[model samples]
Target: MNEYKIEDLLFEELILMDQEASDYEDLITQIGELAFEKGYVDKEFSKAVIEREKLYPTGLPTNKVKVAIPHAMVRDNVKKSAIIISKLKKPVLFKEMGSSTDSFIPVDIVFLLAVNGSKDQLTILQKLVGMFSDDDAMVKLNDMKTASDTIGVLKEILSQ
Candidate 1:
């Protein structure tokens, strides 16, 4: 079995769609509130992620899909750790990581992330990035209608 299970990292309460946000902070606030309500992290998580993202944007534009894996080192503020997967109702502009000119692009799929430790975060992130790099996986992930479906796909991929 995989040491890190996607099912364990993902939860029904953390999956959401049909949210509308005009900017980065707006979306992070909405995501952070849900995670806070579920007792995964504190209210400061949103601010932390927003601040971190400004310095290190996580927007990844793939051949199949566009995504942003937003996260923070919120060890001081985190109560627990969980990952939130969401699809925005509309694409929001985010600065690309390592961009010299500060270019920005629209990102629709976002992975709002939290992890208890650096080791755990690295393990989970590696699994997620490898999976998301697959064209088929990204297509299916974008097509998922429910959280269960998303979990199922990740479970299947990560279990390999």
Candidate 2:
């Protein structure tokens, strides 16, 4: 079996900018297609994530910047663990996480997750959230000049 480190969950092919999604659903679908193409997940992953977001949104209002960490049921069809990091040219509205009220937030960044199991999901999530919460990280993400720059920052974030 292949050893799955945090690094394993990240690929240069999976990172990109200018997602150009008008809404949350479109954003999720676009990332899902990429995830499928990269052999990280199946087709059902995107649909599941879209539906899941309706019930339990992952729109996190962080200190640095707002981001959505959307995911779906992965126990069955996940071929590999990977995160598809996408940047929105224009922010899209999404429901807030764990809110009793029907609160919505504008998410500038989206982290579409496809992990093999619960452990990997939680581990990467914790790390990703930690890095996303930093003002410096957010700044770097916004000012990234190239795909490799974003990939480099993601690698460093995962290392920490």
Q: Give each model's whole-structure lDDT.
A: 0.81, 0.81
Clashing pairs for model 1 are none
Query: Which candidate ranks first by lDDT, i.e. highest?
Result: 2
Output the lDDT of residue 45, model 1.
Answer: 86
RMSD of each: 1.9, 1.9
Q: What is the lDDT of candidate 2?
A: 0.81
TM-score of each: 0.91, 0.91
- lDDT accuracy of residue 29 in candidate 2: 87
What digit string (tens of lDDT, one per residue) describes model 1 on residues 1-160?
1456555887877888667987988998899998998899888889999999988998876668778888996666677777898887888888886788778768878887787777778787787788778989888877888878877876787778
